[model samples]
Target: MGNQPETHPNPTIDPKSGFNSETRTFQSLRPKTPLPPLSQPLSVTDYTLSLIPSTSLSATAMIDSDTDTHLSYSVFIRQIKSLSSSLKSLFPSLSKGHVALIISPSSLHVPVLYFSLLSLGVVVAPANPLSTHSELTHHVQLTKPVIAFATSSTSTHIPNLKFGTVLIDSPQFISMLNNFNNSEPPRVEVAQSDVAAILFSSGTTGRVKGVELTHRNFIALTGGFYYTNLMLGNLDEKESNKVSLFTPPLFHVFGFFMMVWTIAFGETLVLMKRFDFEGMLKLVEKYRIDSIPVSPPLVVLLAKSELVNKYDVSSLKIVGCGGAPLGKEVGESFAARFPNVIIEQVT
Candidate 1:
C-alpha cells in the first residue's frame, strides 16, 4: 500500500466572534476605541522634554560622528534654557510672533537652538545653507525672520536686516550657552496649534514652498510613533544601545523627523556634516552604526556597489529607505547580499 499522508485536525475557530480559518479579513486585534491624544495644546519641545528619560546612557548624549564631540542631555537642556533666557534679554522683541532663520549644517548647537527657540514660542525656519542668495532671499521674504542664525561661513549669505545674523560657532554664542543666571527661562505659553516650524520643500519641480508644521501636528506624529514601537515590542527590549546615522540634510522633512524620532526613542544619533557615500561606510565601521535612514539612490548603491564588501558593516541590522520608489529586484539583491539586515521601504 502507498504511504498515507499524516492527517491533521481542523484549526480551532471562535464561533462567538465569527473568526475561522476560512476568514479572509477580520477586525483589528486592537480595540475599536479611539486612541487618546494630548488634551491640551503642546509645543514640540515640551513634548520631547516629557519623553526624556530620568536617566539614560546615550539618549541624552548626542555624539557628532565626524567631530567625535558629545552633548549630554543635562547640558543640552541647560543650554536651551540659558540660550532662551539670553535671547529674550538681548532681543525682547523676539517673541511668539517672530521667526528665526537658521542656516547651517548639522551640529550639536542646532538642537539646542531649536529647542530653546520653540520653547520660547518662537517659530524656527531652518533652510539649506547651500541655497543661492536669490533662493534664500525668497525664503527670507516668505518667512520674514526677525533675526538670523548662521555659521561664520554662511552668515554672509544672509542679507542686511534690522536684527542681523548671530554666528553660532562664535565665542559670543558660546557665552550664551554659559549664561546660567536665569537658570530657567520665563515660561512662555505655546499652544499646540501654534506654528512650530516653516520647513521648505525640495525645489525639484518648482520654486520651493514653505510648509507650516504646528505643535499639535508634531505631538500627534510622535504619539503615533510611540504607539507603533510599543506594539512592535521594541521599546522594552533589552538590547545593546542602537546607533543611527543620518546622511540626509536635517533641514529636509525626512531628516528632520528622523532626528526627533531618534530623540524620542533614546537612540544615539551620528550626524554626517554632508553626505558622502565612501565617508558613510567609514562612519558605520567607526561608530558601529546599527541602522541608517537612506534614500532610494543610496539603496541602489548598496545593491550594486562593490565598496560595501570592503567595509566591515556586520553591526548594521536595519536599512530604512524612502524619498522615492525602490524596485523589487533591487530589494531582492540587497537582501541576498546582506541577509542579516532588514530593509524597510517607506513609500
Candidate 2:
C-alpha cells in the first residue's frame, strides 16, 4: 500500500480545478432535487452536514424486504460513525471519495456499509461472492479500490492485487464500531457526475469492462424503471417471482438495475450467487418461487432440467429471458414445458 496515492483526509482544492471533484458532483443536480451549496467548507467524515445525504438521513431504517428483520436507520448510522472513527486510527490518510469493496453476506451489513462509505464520500465497489480469483483481480485493477471489506471466505481468494484490506468476520464489524468519536468525518467533495459505483460488465467478448455509473445516471436509470413499471403496473411483475438468473451478475447493470432496484421497493428476491439448474429447482421447491429471471441458455436448460416437474412450481408465473434472442423452437419448447409460466422476452 506504500505505492498507493496519499489519502486526503481534508478537502483539498485540486490545483487545476481548484475545485473538489467529489464536491462538484454532489453539488450537481440529483434526480429529485438539486444539491445545495455549502455555507462553509465541509468534511466528508462529518455526516451531520445536512447536504450530503440530504433528508434521507434517519435514526432507524426498515430494510429487509426479503426477510422479516427490523432494522433501524438511526442505529445503523451510529454504527457507521463508529466504524469511521475506528478506521481512522488504522488508516490515517483515508479520503472521502476513496473506494471500498464490501464483501459481507449479511443483508443487514449491505445497507450499513453502503451508507457508511457514502457518508464519508467514499465510493463503493460491490463484487459478486461467486467471482473467481481472476474476476476479483480484474475488478481491483479497474477500480483501484483503496480497501476491501470482506469475510474470511474471500480473504484467501484475492490474488496479487495490491490495496489495503479489512476483514469483517462477525466480531470485526462490531469491534471497528467500538472506537467511536476519535476522528473527524472525511471532508471530500462529491457530485452527481462522480461515480457512486463502477460495476464491471461482462460483455459479449468475455472481457469485463467497468461501467461508470454516475450518481445521477444510476438514479435516473433506477428511477426510470421504477416509474415505467409503476405506470405499466409491472410492479408485481417481479414480486415473488421465482426465477433463476443464469446469465446476469448482480455486479452487472442488468442485474442491479433490473433485479435489485425492484427488491428495494418490495420484491422478495431469491438471490443465487450463480445459476445452477439443480440448485435453482431446489430453491423453487423450497421457497415456492413464483417467477425466475433468466437468460436464453438457462431458459433452454430449464427445459432440460426436467427437475422442474419434481418441484411445486405452480407458484411461478413469469419466466423471463434476455441477453440474446432465443430460437423460436427453443422458446416454444420452454413454453410447452412451462405452460403455466408466462414467457417474457426483453423488448
Candidate 3:
C-alpha cells in the first residue's frame, strides 16, 4: 500500500440506549459546523448579510400582516445602508461602543434599524413598547443608552437621553431611509466579542435585569440554525419561498433572535403588531406560513382552540416551542391534532 490512513476506535456507547457511559452523556451525532476564526473581526449583521443568496434580493423580505405591506430584500438592504449613513450624519456623537434604546412595536422599520445599528457597531437595547414610564426609566438606567428610537405613541414614556429620541413614525425618519447622499456609512470594524444587544428579562420572578449579548453570541446562534437547516435538507433552491410568522414580541429574546435567524436565511417573515388568535390563523392561511415560533400558551391554544379549524393551516410544517416547560399532555395533544406538523421543543 502506498499509504495507510490512521483509524481510531469508535466511541463507546451503551447498546441499549446509545448513551456514552464513559462521559456520562450522549454525544451529538450531527456533523460539526465550521465557524470563522474567533480572532476575525465580524459583526452579526455582516455575517447574516453574507448568507443572503443574491437571488433572494428581489424576493419579499418582510410583510406587515396587519396592513398587508410588503418589503423586498433589495429595498431592505438599501434602507439599512441609508439609515446607517443618515444616523451618522444626524448624530455625529453616536458611535461604536454607544448604546441606543429602541422602543417600538413590531414593524418593518425595526429590522432595518436593528441591522443598521449593528453594522455601525452600536449596541442595541430594545425594550417593550408597552412598558410604563417607570419601567422604561429602569431600562434607561440599566443600559444608559445615549440615543433612543421610539414611535410617536411610545416616545412619551421614554426619558430623555444624550441624543434625545428619534421617532420612527415621523416623516423625518422616512426621509432618512430615503437618503439620497449615495455615500455609504463609514466601515466599522466590530469585534465579535463586543456587546451587540441588551435585552431585559420578563421580571416574573423579580426585578427585570438587562442581559448582555455579544456579536459573537448571535453570530454563533444564527450560524447554528443555518447549518442545522442545511443538515436537515431544509434549505433548497426554493428556500426564499419559505414563510415564518413571529407571534412573540420583537423586544423579547425569543423574537429578536428568531427575526435575525429568519433574515439570515432570506425567508419571508410575517409580523403582527398585535397578537390576535384569529388573526394569526388568517395570516397563516393567507401567506402559507411554513413555520412559527410559539410559547407554551400558544401551543395549548393551537391544540384546543376551535378557531384553528376555521382557516387552512395545512401549510404549517413546524412549531418551535420554548421559553418555558411545556406540559407532556399539552405536547401530546398538539402532536395529535397537528399530526403532520413537527413540534420542536427547545429546552
The true-versus-predicted C-alpha distance at residue 35 of model 3, in Å, is: 1.0
Candidate 1: C-alpha lDDT: 0.80
Please report how far candidate 3 places residue 311 from its true position, in Å: 1.1
- Per residue, candidate 1 scores C-alpha lDDT tens digits across 16-55 of 3434556653333332222334467567887876665554
- Per-residue lDDT of candidate 2, residues 24-108 (tens digit): 6322121232222333333222322222122233322333323535444345556676676666656766666677776545455
lDDT of 3 by residue, 30-135 (tens): 4556678879999999999999877788999999987899999999999999999999889987889899999999999999999999999999999999999899
The predicted structure with the larger lDDT, 1 or 2, is 1
For model 2, the run of ten residues with the poorest summed lDDT: 27-36
Cα lDDT for residue 212, candidate 2: 68
Question: Over the full model, what C-alpha lDDT does candidate 3 score relative to the true structure?
Answer: 0.90
lDDT accuracy of residue 114 in candidate 3: 95
Best by TM-score: 3
Off by over 4 Å in 2: 1-93, 102-120, 127-138, 157-163, 174-190, 203-207, 234-249
The positional error of residue 99 in candidate 2, measured at the CA in angstroms, is: 2.1
Quote the RMSD, in angstroms, for model 3: 3.9
Give the C-alpha lDDT of model 2. 0.58
lDDT: which candidate is best?
A: 3
